[model samples]
Target: MTQTVPRASATATPADALAAGIGFLRREQDRAGWWKGELATNVTMDAEDLLLRHFLGILTPQAAEESARWIRSQQRADGTWATFPGGPADLSTTVEAFVALRLAGDPADAPWLTPSAEFIRDQGGIEAARVFTRIWLALVGQWSWDDLPNLPPELVFLPSWFPLNVYDFACWARQTIVPLTVVSTLRPVRPLPFDVAELRTGKRPPKTRTPWTWDGMFQNLDTALHAYAKLPFNPIRKAALKQAAEWILARQEADGSWGGIQPPWVYSILALHLLGYPLDHPAVKAGIAGLDGFTIREETDQGWLRRLEACQSPVWDTALAMTALLDAGVSAGDEMLVRATDWLLGEEIRVPGDWTVRRPSLAPGGFAFEFANDGYPDTDDTAEVVLALRRMGKPDHLRIRGAVDRSVAWLEGMQSRDGGWGAFDADNTQVLTTKLSFCDFGAVIDPPSADVTAHVVEMLAAEGKTGTRECRRGVQWLLDHQEDDGSWFGRWGANYVYGTGAVVPALTAAGIPRSSPRVRRAVRWLAEHQNADGGWGEDLRSYRDREWAGRGDSTPSQTAWALLALLAAGERESEVVTRGVEWLCARQRPDGGWDEDKHTGTGFPGDFYLSYHLYRVVFPLSALGRYVRGGS
Candidate 1:
């Protein structure tokens, strides 16, 4: 699931660019004939999926209408929406808008419909929808599911330790595939529980690009996964499925959901339903109702950002914001710090999760992304937040500071000996378990990504805790990871750009010299990659496409990172520095905001991207805030 992005792939045309992107994606499809990447998990997808079901008679007309009413009510005024502030009008959003309008019974001229449709059409029409979207169509027989890569129900056979086994798949995929195996094998089109015949154009678009066959290694390896999938399952495989089901079911939280994420929830719904749970069963009903709660409402002059799903990251967000503001040179004890700190205090996660299993030696409590995500957030944010607070030049409220200490202690115990930190727990390093033929995921079991480990290192240094045995190990790990190009891979951000940006500053803070070869090489990398527009960008493709090498259109946040790296290296007058700074100034929203745009936020590099609306503002502000202060 993890990949080191290489250089850009050459594409003579936009058509070629997209063709290559999709083609590259196509090859990743499983033998199950299903293509699932990061599960898009946004409100738009949920909303539109409901609408599609309704329009196509898969759900009741009344249900469809009700959902459409809810969706229509969430739009903003600017005729466009960025999932995050100053972000872009996601094609997924546009597609959802179109389908929702159809459910609303809007005539073709419906004011919003026209603009939304235009946007959808412009973004490559139906074809532009992600492979997952197409997979949905294939399910309804609107598109051919056969066209899907074969997903034999038999992958149920592989043992966890074997290469290509189910454990190789991330936790998310593990939950989904168990059920998907049933669905694909059964391949039954449940009766439309409502009418959606009106939305389609009635034809698949003409072939637009060349087939995307790579060095053909994947093409061949794919054969093994597919072959194993076809093999008969012994009792062991059946028992594995039983274990997987129980595992998934037991993990479902009190509200009847799993993963604090939508994709898993959706699949859980499908899985249980197939397991003979009726539509009205309590678990099924709860799962269905949970979908309704996953929406957000923000009316503005610009278009509404009906985020595919509401954020489940309050704890994560609050912690990161506190840390980011502090990094921006904000004085400690400022109102922002106290407010964020207070929020973090109240939001500590008090339960155990997968991290607990991977590290039974650690304590039971862990944090979640949001106060609600009580599922995953454990060490990453907590560790970083502790670092942020420990370094603050302010007094913490007694109660809050104590909570921070508990959090930090937990992180210290969670550190891997290499000094690099994994996000949730320590010693969870069983990558071999998930690489089986049954696995189909981007999340590795416990691999330490550079971005995350670097954040931990920076946090330690900020607290003047660097050079300790553990911290030094983390530093060495970072040093070891530096690419020949000087950039390390960013695990949480885009790709190399984000990794390099973070690595350089942390190393410098640890007292790595500006002239150190590592620092100079990173500086050169940043300088060389700086865009003409003064900003920086690495496409989502960087997650899966080494050729794209994480390079792409410039955005404020990426530009800021580039600037931050160069700035840390004391590259004040570097030509790259000037252009990057200028780009930020020019792109500033008149309201002192940057576009709620620029895909700097990282999801699993390729399958999903984030519109960190705040990035447009927070980062630009950080860079600008520090820069305009008379060059420090």
Candidate 2:
């Protein structure tokens, strides 16, 4: 079983003057409409996948080609890839690139390909490739026979209510996993007449007993799942698989995507092909073709920078940008704020997602998306938008205010019995699902996470939810969630630093006194956690290492987060503040941004992390601009 990590010590609260500073921030928002910048998913992983396709001479459109190239160009000389700069290189990503470049027609003897293959061999060669990577390799017969886990396309034959039912995985995983089940069962490895000398594992892997064990990480689970394929099954299972395939087809998003994510698309396309469907198959063709839209093309000095088919969430972006602008002293009716409000208004989620499961009574009209995420249902967007609008000058800015109020009402109604909020669903108490061996994940349901709940608390507090039963409940929830060391677990951000930063402002905004015992402890944690460079950063590894929970090798965006949290906690003249500001200013790139190589956000603990492109700009500008103007 997984365990929550230890928290850091909470510090003493500061004097009352801190209230004025927070008020300055809250008061500057546009009439309670929420907004936040979109976070880009793991670029390294996402990019390498695109490059692999390109390397195969698949020849994506010009834009996608450039993006894939750009991603490949960023590959460090070490022949390894990382989600963020200077972080540990991931094996799966490296292997993906090695194969992609080889497909791009680069000879294995090429200078770059040599080191890349060497690195892969050193890391266990083809044996170490992730199941997903192996599946891709199997597509082209790059790997040998009998080595892959058997996922007979016949699984299209299983029922919904069974133990390994189709819907058991999280929505994100389900989309990809469902299709893969079909593809693997068929086991169609395309003929690779060309040399794959670099990809050989040097030997076939040994078979194993007891394939089920969470102790082995995601890879071990792959081995186990493959082992289960050898077992016998009954006739009743045959009908269920058909139902699942039908369900999969029916739920395809309007944009030809499932859950607005890529993995499912790739897997689904492969699976359909294995199911006797050709390239002309409607679902297969649309699925393969839709990815082109997600590519982001950027021209670089070296040819072009290529990207993959991933989403872009602008609705969330506008909301967060508005908040940053407001905090920087832009008042009511500010041009930027108005434009942001308009953008957010256009981006609201009118149709509910699976979140409606916990909230049957609430209407489907809520959620926000960055332009990229397009139509995936989400909660943080609505919550943050509420905070943004509530801070606007006109108490009666009808349109934005109406949306905020409606969103607030919807958000309030969705709160779980636990007194906190979840991102997509509530009362996700199906803990039994997590206990299953195939479930190599943390939680299936979107339970009340620290980040989502804090966003709700922050929004409601801005809209004068202060001291109300809801406010108190939310505040108490945060207080209750705090670890003995005084920090809360940041379900969404990288580590405790994110949890701590979010809660301090929320509690303070909800009328918690500057000196409240709870408030005091959170502040002290931030003050004490500052790095020697007068900045703050927490490694993504902190998700695993409790001791280094909120520690990172100082960066601008993180420093801004720490400073913002400290300022919210009423520490104006603290030495940490001066040093944070100095670090940001000193490191500001000529393009008016900071180089944030650290992954400040989490996707799934130990599975993925995000390097938000805008976090470097907006968060620092909000903090630095405020400090420049005599912020607390």
> Residues 1-632, candidate 1, lDDT per residue (tens digit)?
11122213322232232233223323433432222222123346546457434433456555555556555654555344334333457665655555555645666667866666666666676555654555455454544544444454445566654654544555555556656665554444533322333344445644423335432344445455455555586565456556555656776765566666666777667666666677788877776766656545344564433334523555554554454455455566665566555555566666666555445666644355643556566566776567655655445557656666666556666787666777655654665544332233245455677887877777677667786776788889899988887888887777788888778878887778889999999988887776655577776666667765546777767877777788778887677776676666655543444453345666555445555554554455555544544231
Q: State the C-alpha lDDT per candidate.
A: 0.58, 0.64
Question: Native-vs-model 1 lDDT?
Answer: 0.58
The parts of candidate 2 lying over 4 Å away from their true place are 1-72, 143-168, 193-242, 272-289, 372-375, 393-396, 429-445, 466-470, 589-591, 625-632
Model 1, position 172, has a per-residue lDDT of 55
Model number with the top TM-score: 2
Best by lDDT: 2
Q: Report residue 88 deviation for candidate 1 (angstroms).
A: 15
lDDT for model 2 comes to 0.64
Q: Weakest 10 consecutive residues, lDDT, candidate 1? A: 1-10
Model 2's TM-score against the true structure: 0.81
